[model samples]
Target: MASFKEEVYEHISAVYQTAADEIKNGLSLIKEVWPLIFLLFLALAVLIWFAKPAPPDKVLMATGTGGSYKVLGEKYKAYFEKRGIDLKLVETHGSKENLQHLIDRKDPIQAAFVQGGMIAVDNLSGVQSLGSVDYEPVWIFYRKNTFNEGIHVSDRDIAKLRINIGPIGSGTHAQAVSILKQNHLTPTAPNLLSMNNADAVNAIEQGEIDAVFLVDGYESPNVQRLIKNPNIRLVTFSRADAYTRLLPYFEELGVPMGGFDLGKNIPDHPIQLISTTTNLLIDDRLHPAIQVLFLEAAKEINGAKSYFSKAGEFPVYMNTEAPLSNEAKFFYEKGTPTLMKYLPFWLAEFLERMFFLLLPFAAFAYPIIKSIPSYRTNLAKKQINSIYKDLDKFEQNTIQTFDPNRRGEYIEVLNDMERRVLASKAAKLATADCYSLRNNIEFIRNALEKQVIYKGR
Candidate 1:
């Protein structure tokens, strides 16, 4: 019986041998498939390089100094914060300044709430729209006692009075200038004062300015305060249809009687207002994922039913001041991406990028992976063939020189070659070739023995 220690050593030796064999096979396989491995890595590197970068953790958006735009910006900021993103809001005069910020590449503002009709669409190039978010009506409020009672007010009449057409570089100012020009009135007239929404509201409330032209939503504090004040009256643009025709970007909005306050019958009459949409514009170079996030935020914040908008009616492709972004177009066509519905924002984005990267990589790597076994097999055959060539050379030398004096040395060389063949890793893969080599060695050894015996005789 084998001793216990000897048996234990034998077991350890067998385990070690198995592990070494596995390592050798792994290395051999890697060597044979090295080119395929290199190609796969190269393909992966190219895909990663071309892939869209991850959505930025911090972004800057331009809102208005005050009014609904600033309010909307706060809502969007809260939405972004929930997704682990920082949305910094920069307050400007209004849409005109916001559009300028978006167009200037050096400006840190990546997105803004731009009012339609503020500028010509042809002049905007570096900005794209995530679509219009809400209605910003051209609210014309005047002191009830300023104009003659029960008389219709004309654009020319308003231009001659002390009127606040909003600050320079504001959407209200742009619209006011356009309206005044259409009426053949001078917008540069001294009576067309430039004041911001709050100051203009205050000036009109104090009966200092005869009237104020504001472009804002009904929810704006300035518009609301003026609406509640019995002293100020909201203008009903009787020529609203003509204005829409003259200003192609303008839309006509109707407010029924008591639209402002049904309890108090605030307006006391149905009103026709000329309005424009608030477009969510972004830098054309903004990341696609971030654009998608903005669109989603628009849906959540602006899609709700409001005084002027029906539920899910906004965030639509209406009154687009600039071309719709690719992401926004996709969103309108298909809603939010499926991944974003269930997963966290960052994780969903990561998986989406990886999916796109791996899709092409898998197509490239499949054939190479499938051929690895064949490549490794071919390598094994080549190694066995090399040993066969050495055997053939030895046989030729033996037959030509007839080295009877060094017969022992020739036999020793044959034994060494056989030993090497049996020990070779390649021999395991080409078992048939290894067996054939052993048979050839035996036949050569027998011939050497016979020749030596015959020479001695």
Candidate 2:
């Protein structure tokens, strides 16, 4: 005999009550899964803690001073500075010294400019080449008297050759020996001079030296003297192509007629010469970020046309003594990292390394990451269903225990279970479940009242 308004209110109250209990049950299940969440969070923290150290903030390089290596190294330093890195450039005796520094792993040097042909591919182990940056032409200037005055020294008269190749422990010196060796000179080739470009030029000008071998480009200041002085003649290789074939690092290139001066028409025609490229060498352990920067700098500085190469001809993809590093290969294949194109260098580098870490985590933890909701729902449902089963067994006990004393104990136990079910509602429970647990509580109360009325007497 309830009014329509009262009935509607009662229905709404029941619905809200059911929803509250279902949610509380769900929360109890979630509480059971707390241990899983705690462990997962701990693992994530460890991963972040042990992430690879930030890309090196700086690096040291070995290069030749007062030459293209020094000049180009300066340009590279500038480029690195813009990207928040510092380059420590150390000047050394040319390619040969550079190679020694790289081989000595204990040294702090990370990179250097080494001329090709100085070291054989077999000898290179822990280092790698980015690529040849530019062609290092072999400029041989000799006294005109050797050939013009009929004073040419025969093959065996190398003792009378009186040549200055370059100083010992230098790229030009190595190239000089290589060239002489190809001509069948022994390791201790006689009359081999050890002098730098300046002294070599002075000696040639004074007729103190018969010939001078310079491994550099037309940009060399000494080469200018050879070009301008009519008393000196460039020694052209008659079998340049054959030399190139014998030496993997050698290339048969020509110094174009009038290349130095169109007015004087220096060579009068193309003169054949054997040359090697100046390759940038890197330690195998150098940071990959720095490697990419070196390549980018080389492309910018050596990609232009020079006396020996056309525009975009340098930073050659050709192989060198040391195998190319993986970073160099990647740059050659993919140009630049996709992230680097948009983000700042520091940010991009950090994110790139992080992505590598996250990639593995995402792959290996796919199941772990996915089981969150599954475990949550399972725990929630388990809690909800467990309470219902306990109630069922208690209800059966009440039906079976008909003795007054036993029924009184059953009622007490039933009351205690209802109190526990209501207490569980204090926890954070799943909201979707709409079981208030009130009906079950009411059933227990009614059963207890029946026991008192039917059996208490």
Candidate 3:
């Protein structure tokens, strides 16, 4: 049987062998999974490389009830189709129904022009604003005789008159009711005429109704022509300030005389109007591509100079149930693609997709790639430290006793440490350290072989 010291040495050697084998086995397993791991890495690369889907060949949109939404929807549909996107127009029952349809996940409605206040917080759930297209001022076209009462009409007179409220679920209906309710008029049981703005106007012209209410931007040519009628007059809310105070989202706007046409002098006097915003409501989970498409379209549609809104005011993001997605928020804050600004529409959209794909990788590649070298260096450093402790123990034993039998055993340990340290090849330590230790091992070997007792050997 081997001596005690030899037994210890053999045990240490066995431990070293087992550890080395385990390391090799671990490395082998790592190599096996490396392909799948690389695939995972490459998947992220692919996402960053081609993340954006191609813009749809056809775009879908919604218009308010009556002619405005239909006319505008048709016009935009043609515009987008000219740019290679076929714009599909879906008629909705005006702003409230349009917003409800947008919130319904089952509905394929990607975008809709909704009267802003038509959507309450509960109704706005799961919907985001792409921006508003135009302001729809609450226009009260009452007969000149009914226009008496100086902007503050009494509830009794309003109740007695035949009021043409808009269609059920239309924003116009909601606005008319809200305005009427504020003045203590009860239309719930009153004889109500359910019709769109155009029909209401015709009804009034035909003597079927006494008054009609419409809420739309002043830029509407139809509205321009209606106001020009000598028989019908635009009702100015003398107390517009009070209505604005009652409705936080309402803005008191003025339709200046000759504002529509300076040469024509359309309005003889400035018409005071109170209006609510309109929104391009979309689903919360709407695809980023679709969201971008709507926003970009909105930028073109709503940014025009209108009587009620200036450029960049319609797509307001606040107070929506479906908050704007991060990508949409980013684009809104930073503005749309430069190509969308300068290039033709089709080319700009394609480049925008490519840019979305490449940007993340362009942002994150360097740091992750550089970590491999750093990890290997740390592993080597730990291995070097482990070997150094065993070397120090052997060195202390050598100083305590110089017995011949123990000297050879200690030399073997020194040799073992030296070989293991070289195997580790820890990059943190200088190469000079390994060579110097080798020289010490050589001196120990020489002294053990010759049985020479040099001082401090």
Best by lDDT: 1
Alpha-carbon TM-score of each model against the true structure: 0.88, 0.76, 0.63
Where model 3 places Cα greater than 4 Å from the true spot, the runs are: 1-52, 121-123, 145-159, 189-191, 257-266, 310-322, 342-457
How does residue 448 of candidate 3 score in lDDT? 65
Candidate 3, residue 49: the lDDT equals 60
Report every candidate's CA lDDT. 0.86, 0.76, 0.68
lDDT of 1 by residue, 33-90 (tens): 7887998899889988998777889999999877999888999999999999999999
Candidate 3 lDDT over 1-457, as tens digits, reads: 8999999999999999999999997785455345444755896777956575676676567785445676667766765766677778887778777776777778877777777567664655677766555666888776666665355342234455687878877787888888878887765746677787777887777677887778776655556656766566666677888988897657788878777558777555677788876666666665665566666766677666555677766555633534566767777788875776788777877777777665676465555555545555555566765766666676566666667667657677777877787775463344555566667667766766775644554
Candidate 1 versus the native: TM-score? 0.88
| Per-model RMSD to reference | 4.5, 8.3, 13.4
Off by over 4 Å in 2: 1-53, 121-123, 144-159, 187-190, 205-207, 221-232, 339-344, 347-374, 384-420, 423-445, 452-457
